[model samples]
Structures are given as C-alpha cells and as structure tokens.
Target: MHASDTVDEQLELAADLPPWEKLASKARALKVMEEANKIIEDFPTWEYWVFFLLFMTEFFLAVYVSINLLK
Candidate 1:
C-alpha cells in the first residue's frame, strides 16, 4: 500500500530465486537455438544469396572504375 511495502515485496521475490536459475535460463536459450536450426534446415531459401551477389558485383565495379580514373 505504501512505498516501503512495495519495496519489501520486490526484495522478497528476488531473494526467493533458486541458485540454478541462471543455468536453467541458458538451457532454455539453447533449446530455442536448436529449434531455429531445425526450421532453417527444413525450408531454406536463396533470395538472400541473389541480392548479396548483386550488391558485391556493383561494389567491385565502382571500386574498379575509381581506381582506373586515378591512374
């Protein structure tokens, strides 16, 4: 009801945590990564590769033209 009461509740909750909470959180995160890998393996796409190749080609052409102009 008061500011001190709210602070006491928060402190109590924090103190009641199990010692292995951090380890358990990391395990849950690893499980999520494993699931993501499975999904990506099942449905791989290649539009990203096409865009990447186009970007690199344009970048190299620009660099080549600039170097030839300086020489």
Candidate 2:
C-alpha cells in the first residue's frame, strides 16, 4: 500500500481508540510539529499581548488628555 493508504489505515484505527489516544498519535507524529513548536515558542502568550495593548492605549489616552487639558 502507498503512504496515503497507510495514513488512512491509521486514521481508521484511531477512530476506534479512546479520545486521548487520538491526541497522543498526532502529538507523537512529529512531521509538522517542529514548525508548530517554533510558532508556539516565538509568540508571546495571549495574556502578555493583551496587557501590553491595554497599557499602551492607556498611556496614549493619558497623554492626549493631558495635552488637551492644557490647551
């Protein structure tokens, strides 16, 4: 059988396994995992970015208000 057939077979088998087993199979299969890990490692987490945005926006708003108040 070809590679595609092998993948199909694995998928069919996975369907019969437990939910965690399905996740384990993909986690163990590292074909696309290196890139996925790279992305995970490179990006700041969601919480950090959200806080950064709020802080920057607050800073800018304070500055604008200060300028307008003085005029």
lDDT of 2: 0.70
List, residue by residue over 15-64, the lDDT tens digit for candidate 1.
55675754454455556666767887877469878888999999999999
Cα deviation of 68, candidate 2, in Å: 1.0
| Strongest candidate by TM-score | 2
Error of 1 at 61 (Å): 0.6
lDDT of 2 by residue, 1-71 (tens): 23233444555667878989876655544434555668779999899999999999999999999999999
Q: Estimate each model's TM-score.
A: 0.42, 0.44
On lDDT, the leading prediction is 2
How far residue 51's Cα lies from its native spot in candidate 1, in Å, is 0.5
RMSD of 1: 12.8
